[model samples]
Target: MHSEVAQLFRYSLGFIAAISFVACLCIIALAQVFPWLCGRRDDENAVQSMHSRPTPRIGGVAIFFTLALGVVFAPTTIVQSYLGVIIATTLLFLVGLSEDLGFRVSPRRRLLAVCVASLVVIVLLGVWLPRISMPYFDLLMQYWIVGVPFTLLITAGVANGFNLIDGVNGLAALTAIGASVSIALISLQAGYDTMAMVSMMLAAVIFGFFLVNFPFGIIFLGDAGAYTIGFVLSWFGIAVLIDSSQVSAWAILLTLFWPLADTVFAIYRRSRSKKDAMAPDRLHFHQLVMRGLEICILGRKRRRIANPLTTLVLAPFVIAPQVCGVLLWDHNRAAFFTVLAFLAVFIASYLVAVPAIRACRQRPQEA
Candidate 1:
C-alpha cells in the first residue's frame, strides 16, 4: 500500500509539473508578442515599478488557468476533498487578475475579497487555526469563534504579503518557490503526500516563470501572480498544520518567513516615517539591497545586471529560515525559538544594510 501510494504521488507530481512547464513557456511567448493576451504593464505610477518598458504582468493568468486545468487531472478523491480550497484560490486569482489589467482596485476591497475567500475555506472546508504553538493562544484557538477570525486575519495578511514583496525581478517568485519547497518537505515528512505534491507543483510553475523573469526581466508576475501564489502557499501551509499535529506552527511560519518578515518591517518602517501604512515606496528591504548591488557590487558599468543579481545575492538569506524550519519541523518549542532567532538576524541585517545602501545611492556617479 505504501509503495502504491508513493508511485501515485510521483505520477501526480510529474503530470502537474509537465503541464505547468508548458503553460509557462506558452505564456512567456505570448507575453512578448500578444500585448492583450497578458495584461500590458506600463511602468507608471506603481510602487514596484523598476523597469522602463511595458511588459505583461499577467503571468498569474497563465499560472491560474494552467493550475485549474491541472486540477482536473488530480485524483477524484483529492479533488472532491479539496474542492473548497480550489474554489477560493480561483476567486482570489480573479481579484488579482482584474488589478493586473490596470483596474483601480481599492486596497480595502482587495483585502475584503481575500477575507471572503479565506472565510469560505474556513466555514465550508473546515480549515482553520487549530493551534498557534503558544499555550495561551492554543487554548483560546480551540474555540471556533476565536480560531476562525484569527485564521482569516493570517490568510489575508499572507495573501497581501506576496504583493508587498513583488518589487524586483525574481524576488517574489523565488521566495514563493522556497516557501513551497519547505511546505512540500515538511508535508512529506508528516506523511501527507497529496499536499506535498501540490506544493512541489507550485514550486515547479514558479521555477518555470522564474527563468524568463530573472536576469532578463522579460515578464513580471504582477498583482495576479503574487496574490495567487501567496494565497495558495499560505493556505497549503495551514492545511499541513491542520492535517498533522506533528507539524509545528513555527515551521509553517518559517516556510513563509521572508515575506512575513518583509511585510512586518515595511509596516514598521512606514509608521516610523509617519507615512500611511499602506503607502508604497521603493525603500523596501529588497529595493535597498538591489540599489547597493547596483552601485557597489555591480558597479556603474554593470548596473544593468543589478536587478536580477539582487535575487541571486539575497535568495540564500531568505531561504535559510525555511531550511532551519524544516530541520526543526518536529520540535515545536525549538522551531519557535529558531524562528525568532532567524527573524532577529534578518532584521539586524536589514537595518545595517539600509544605511550603507543609502550612502551608495548618494555617492557620485562613476562615469
Candidate 2:
C-alpha cells in the first residue's frame, strides 16, 4: 500500500508538471500575438520615458487562461481542494484587466472587487488562517467573524502588494516565481499535495512570463497579471498553513516578508508625508535601485552598476534571513520575534538609504 501510494503521488506530480509547462508555453505564444491583434505597438517613447516599453500589458490574460486550464485539468484531489482559489483568482484577473485597459476604476472600486472575491473564497471555499500560536493563550479563539475579516484583509493586501511592486522589469514576476516554487516545495514536504500542485502551476506560468519580462523587456504583467499572481499565492499560503498540523501561521508570514514589509513601509511613508495613501510614487526599493543605477552611470563613477543588479543584490538579502529563520526555528514565538526584528532592521535601513539615494540622483553631473 505504501509503495502504491508513493507511486501515485509521483505520477500525479509528473502529470501536473507536464501540463503546466505546456500551458505556460501556450500562454506566452498567445501573449506575443495579442498586441498586434489589438492594434497596439510596443510604445517606443514610453520605453524611453519610462523604464520599460509599453508591451502588450495583457500578458495576464494568458496567465489567467493557462492557470485556469491547468487547475481544471489537474487531478481530482487538487481540483476539489483548489476550486475556490480558481474562482477567486478569476474574479481578480477580471478586475485587473479592466484597470489595465483604461477602465476608470477607482482605488475604492478595485478594493471592493478584491473584497468581494476574498469573501467568496473565504466564506464559500473556507480558505483561512485556521491556527496561530498565541504566546499567553493556550488556544486562540477561532471566531468566524474575526477570522473572515482578517482573511479578507490578507487576501486584499497580498493582491495590492504584487500590484504595487510591478514597477520594474522581472521584479514582481521573478519574486512570485521564486516564492511560489519555495512554497510548493514546502507543501510537498508537508504532504499537502493539493497546495503543492497549485503552487507548481503558478510558478511554471510565472517563469514563462519572466523570460519575456527580464533582461530585454518584451512584455509586462500589468494589473491583471499582478492581481492573479497575488491572489493565488496568498490563497496557497493560507491553504498550506490551514492544512498542516506542524507548521505555524508565522511560517507563511516569514516567507512573504519582503512584499509585506514594503506594503507597511509604503503606508507609513505616505502617512508621514501627508500624501494620499493610494497615490503612486517612485520611492519603492526597486525604484530606488533604478535611480541609483542611473545616477551612477551618468556620473561616470568608477563603480557603475545595472538596475537588475540592484534588485539582485537587495531582494535576496531581505528575503533570505527570514526564510532561514522560519525553517530553522520550531517555536512560533521565537520565529515571530525574529521576523519582527528583521522587519525593523529593514525599515531602518530603508530610511537611512532613501535620503542618500535621492541625493545621489539629484546631484549635478560634471560638465
Leading candidate by TM-score: 1
Residues 238-264, candidate 1, lDDT per residue (tens digit)?
A: 889889999999999998888888888
Looking at model 2, residue 278 earns an lDDT score of 78
Give one digit per residue, the lDDT tens place, for model 2 in 149-197: 7777887787888887776667787778767866766676677765666
lDDT of model 1, residue 121: 82
Off by over 4 Å in 1: 1-15, 32-42, 73-76, 300-303, 362-367
| Cα error of candidate 1 at position 153, Å | 1.6
Residue 295 error for model 1, in Å? 1.8
Superposed by TM-score, candidate 2 places the C-alpha of residue 305 at a distance from the truth, in angstroms, of 8.4
Residue 112 Cα positional deviation in candidate 2, in Å, after optimal superposition:
1.7
Q: Which stretches of candidate 2 lie over 4 Å from their true place?
A: 1-52, 136-141, 297-307, 362-367
